[model samples]
Target: MRPSIKILEEDMKEKVVLEAMEILEEIGFFVENTEAVEILRNAGINVDSETQRALIPADLVKKSLKTAPQSISLYNRDGDFVTVLGGDNICFDPGSAALNVLDQETNEIRTAVTKDFVDFTKVVDQLEHIQAQSTAITCSDVPEKISDRYRLLIALIFSKKPIVTGTFVKESFEVMKDMLVAVRGSEEELRRKPLAIFDACPSPPLKWSDLTCQSIIDCAKYGIPSEFVSMPMTGATAPVTILGSIVQHAAETLAGLVITQIVSPGAPVIWGGSPAAFDMRKGTMYLASVDTILMDLGYVEIGKYLNLPTHAYLGMSDAKILDTQAGFETGMGSLLAGIKGVNMISGAGMMNFESTQSIQKVVIDNEIAGMTYKFVKGITQRDEPIAKNLLKEFDKKTHLLSHDHTMKWFREELYLPSTVVDRSTNEEWITKGRKSIGERANETVTKLLSKYPGVSLDNDIIEDLTRIMKYENVDFKTKLDL
Candidate 1:
């Protein structure tokens, strides 16, 4: 069932736009890189060479933003299962795993390998609620070409919905192209139906690092939707003020959008960002709060103002590891923001500033996503209509609990908890061995990873993928222990 979206009002959006412009022009942005300073200055912004800042007037910023294509279309192999870039699909992705979270069964934290990644993908395939599978885990098996090789392995394993991925190297971009050609069967087919990759940009102003920017442009040329993530860290990376952060994030996103549009006119793209403030108390960013959640949502508003499909970080927490703090923060933030109709809310089951990943937390987050979906559904009105004719419909003193209608809709109305939770009294709880929620979640993840079977591409397709890997100059899969 699709959730009804509540779009921001036109006037309200315009107000945000006007305010963003004012902030960009008046407040400007603090930039340190002289090369980046030159880029903005050459673009005609008023650059303070001594301060190394770019004070873009509202008109220029608005004009720069106008360079973006309003909407994007993401397609898969066979050009099948294409979803429009915008609207209320509300996609969820796994947490970024440049680092690892606690592994309960292992009794200690460990770096992720290719086996770990394949296991994660297998579990994600079974989740009816998780619409898109992100290229989340880092592959230690093929160290040299991880960016290229893992994407191939995942594509080989799962043939589900569209994938949200990004490439860190030049060959990885070509490796992506090879996988697209293999899955899509032809360059024409792949071109017709492309994937969406998250092109990340360092924030506080619009500046692209060497390899990442080039890779994103390559994807754009091939018609892949590039979801630009402008990660603006408050205090350290960006200004401390939330409003100032918004302007800087906007500028960064708009700049990337322009470059993508230039690479491929009207190519599919997203104005996505997840900029959060630094918690002085904890000294960590991505803190969950009304401010944190709303700030991200508010940026989505600014993005959608351009009539573009938007993405924002949600379902993530500042919790150090998997525990109560993680669960509640995940539940509250994802629950509320999903209710607000955030499209492509990622950071689900992620912790420790998205560097750390947890499978247990992902399961818990799945529960939270399910609950949020239910909350936003509001309530059905079957009883309201039937109540008007209650006397005529039922005999006096009859128990409506046993009515035939009760059996039909009861299941639909209730959100039964998954294995991660318990719905019982003290007596029932004692009888069940009283395992901890985290422990139970660990068992569930192990079970899913063990029992679940994922899609397998043809042998010829696998060979082609391997050949592409050789071209990628990465370690051979046969030699790797993974």
Candidate 2:
């Protein structure tokens, strides 16, 4: 049996869902998009145009819960399976919209730029453990209005992996859709093989921003998958109790589901979030805190109860760098989320409270992801009663290396990590340079980049994407010419 972890019992999960439904009916939520409010009004929902308060009824929530697809498929640009999101399917990707990167050359945090996004995508493409890629960092070099779209463009041009991206600016939404079409050939084909999933977040305290609301409706209309990111800060924007936080998360995501399904029935969406507890002592939100992991697992359990695909922010560090603190936090968060079977666990390369990205840290986390996945896979009984025969034939002079059984099962039974992790004796360490994990990871990154061709697109698609970038007045060639 595969190793797994869960905290909420079935009856407890039902209670959480009931509480969420009650919150949606009694308290309601704010809908900032005027069109969204009108859609709800047309659906017989009680709406106050002045306050934007949409009191979604229990029937509407239940209908949405029924209509939303239970599973979502994300394909790479080449139209291949990156992951099927639902049930026990688990996948990992780096986080999005980080502003800084830990510069390997200088060993200092620097503002991330377009090149940083490109290089990050290259690393993600090479990591077998990372199933999908996100617009890992926003390039400060690009125009603020087009940064989100620019990241998507870079992802398409550099990596063939499925992408997790979003648009913060409303006007750029159509442009982003057009950019996707440029890579995907046409609108219908793009929808049929959606190479990316957009993340639409709802504001805390029961509010959905106009952009995010429109994103939900647009993604539904376009037939692209969307993830509802309901970020609730406990003891600040939400209730302090963990159960209360999950209830709030459920309510918020349910509101999104209602909006999305209302726009287009049976639209695909994932139950996703990046919530955390507010630490009064530090005067900050502990997104990578251990408590946050519990909260994420609880929300995922609720999603599974509804038979929906789930996602969460895990495998990140609240620590400033790739030190001991980063190691333990990332290891624990990744292992727990993987074993819990979160469909799409984000925040792999994240550091310093998820504000920065690092190539070295990503390399390290890639190894962590491999080990966690191995642990989740558990041990399989490849053969029965074979150990008795092997033991009977074994002697003090015999070696397992000489046996055929050892060679056949060793590769499958063990997780042989790459050079990113060190497993050497003191003498072996001295023979080498006694390099740190960071140093070894840096060397690996260098080797990977050296082998990467830097660009992976047909001439026609490249020209079209560049034309779109130029239309936005973005200097795409300047950064990608390498």
Candidate 3:
């Protein structure tokens, strides 16, 4: 889409960049970590000798960002389904941590499980706009020892799209490395068309975790696009103000960029966050508050200053129950963030502090993502006569099935809904027992997985991937593993 489709206009962008430079110069980020400080200084940022407060030259930030190649690709055994190389294309992905009550049999709302993850992945893989899958699905059943990559392994089986995931520990890094190798067929293939991974750092004063830093370094070396998602909870985690949260997010992200870029100058990175504020009344953190949305918008604006792609954690709710609040929170957040051109907006399909994930919400949120894509494209005027002449050619007696125009328009204009909004007539619904969204979603997941084998993967590559998944402790050791 070039800079034209950029969320920030030229004059607007320049002004923002200039102001950010000053903010960095005057206030400076509280980056005490020597690695981060030195990297910023080496990159020609002006750092205060004692405090390590720094201001990066706008030119350097732009240049470094420009080096991040506009596009990145991830492949399945079949081939690349998502290549975020910059286009009019915008799609929604999975939310992290499904901690709500998914299995009604249990009746208690809690964390998601390994099987729950597999089920959720199937529903997402079935989605159209969710071009990449985030193994944000949680595996609550697995021992903590294997929980991190456990969901990722389930995702690997179900998704052909690139899976966005995190490494909570050093060993999970190997699991991810091997997972990509399985998808790419070999280390050489992985290096050639790297998988995109989003990594996060705890916000300022706090440093990148030992596991996360190690993972970033490991990911950079392999050419995978590992982005930094710095989450700062204002009021609770930061200063309880949106502006304060933005700076903290900026500091954390830039520090990550320093390390990642140093590890590999163009180690494909995105500026992203999960920052939000706590609700004082309820004593809970609201993931979809106006403060959260606005702060995220501000962060993306800052990323535009650096000329990098962006990401944010929106579309999540603080609502404890899965109801209208969950839907509206997800929809509104998705709309603005998508309109603002967030490269990726994580946190969908969940309720309660992002600790729980749900298939029902995943399906519904994906539909929202599809709707958001429509908004981002806005409405374009086509020069063609599907404009007028085709409409005139429409005949009342003829069925649309026989009309070429129907096919043309349907392919271009249709935004199909997932299992969210009920589409059946009352009579039809009655006959079908008025199924809940969850019931339909559960059915949809089974249908997709049943259809998976018919959608083929290369046999030799599949064999190699099987070995890697097994070797990396990601399951799929058996010949029957899907």
Candidate 4:
């Protein structure tokens, strides 16, 4: 049997969902977008024109849930099927929208530039365990107006994996969609095989900004998957209790779902969030806190209970550096998320409360992801008689090292991590210069970049991408030659 975890009981999940529907019916959500207001007004829901408060009835929410797809299929840039974001199938990608990167040479956090993002994309492309790439960081070198689509452009040029990306402004979505269409050759094909999932976050305490609401609607109209990232900080923007925060998250996510399904009856959406456990002493929000991880797992359970694809900001650290705290927190969160089988597990290279990205931490997290994948496979009975036949063959004089059984199962049973992980003896370590994990990861990063067979897109496609970006912002200067 596959290993799994569920924090919310069956009855509790029902209760949580019911409370969320009731909250939407009674308290309502503040919908800032005029188009979204009209959509709700046409859907026969009560909308206050002055306040822009959309009172979505429970029946509408239930109907929206019925229309929203349970699974979303994501494809690589080359139009090949990659993975599905539903059920117990889990996929990992680096977190999105980090402002800073841990500089390997200086070992200090600094603003990320185009080069930093390119190197990050290269590393993510080679990681065996990470299934997708993200617009992981914003480029300081580029103009902020085009930053959202600019990141997507770079990912399209360098990596072949499907991206987990989003927009900062309402107008950016059309340009971003045009870029994806350029890669896929047409709008219909791009919609048929979605190349990316856009993240649309709802403001806390039942609020959807005009930009995010527009993003949700645009994604729905184009048949692109929209991931609802509901961030509710405990004891701060949301209620102090974990269950209370989850109720708020459910309400906010349901509101987005209603808007998406209303726009396009069969549009895809994932039930995802990045909720935080507030530390009152320092007034800091901890992404890696046990409380926060529990909240993520709880909401994922609720999503599963609702039979929807789920996502969470787990497998990341809040620590300032890649120290013991980083390892402990990243390992715990990743293993738990893997065990729970969250569909799209984000936050592989993220740190410092998800404000920073570390390529080295990403290299190490690849191994963690590998191990977690193995752990969730559980113990398999490889032989017919279980261990009896193998045990019968064991003798004092003859060990299993030279046996055929060992040769057959060792490779599959054991998860041999990359050289980034140190398993050498003390004497071997001394001979090999005793490099730290960060140092080892840095070396791996160098090796991967050196051997990276650069993606070769047709000249016409390259010109099209560049033309799209240049059209958006005439002054946009890129580190890429194109």
TM per candidate comes to: 0.84, 0.98, 0.80, 0.98
Error of 3 at 49 (Å): 14
Model 1: lowest-lDDT 10 consecutive positions: 473-482
Q: What digit string (tens of lDDT, one per residue) describes model 3 on residues 1-482? A: 22223343557555655554455445655555455556666766676778555655545544555566555555543555565633323446777645444453442476555556665676677787677788776565556666666666666666677778877667777766876677666787877775557565654444565566676667778887776778888787776767667766776676566567666788877777777678888787777877788888888877766667777788677666557787788888888877777777777776677677666666667778888877676555454753676556556544557676667667566666755568889998889989876566556656766775442555665555556445444445342345
* Candidate 1 segments exceeding 4 Å error: 1-79, 148-152, 155-159, 383-386, 390-398, 471-482
Cα lDDT computed for each candidate against the true fold: 0.66, 0.88, 0.66, 0.92
> Considering TM-score, which of the candidate structures 1 and 4 is the better prediction for this target?
4
Best model number under lDDT = 4
- Candidate with the larger TM-score of 1 and 3: 1
What residue pairs are clashing in model 4?
Answer: none
Per TM-score, what order, best first?
4, 2, 1, 3
Give lDDT tens digits, candidate 4, residues 16-72: 999999999999999999999999999999999888898988999999999989999
Candidate 3 clashes: the total is 10
lDDT score, candidate 4: 0.92
User: How much does candidate 1 score in TM-score?
Assistant: 0.84
TM-score of 4: 0.98
- Higher-ranked by TM-score: 2 or 3: 2
lDDT of 1 by residue, 355-378 (tens): 766777777777788888777777
RMSD of each: 4.2, 1.3, 4.6, 1.3
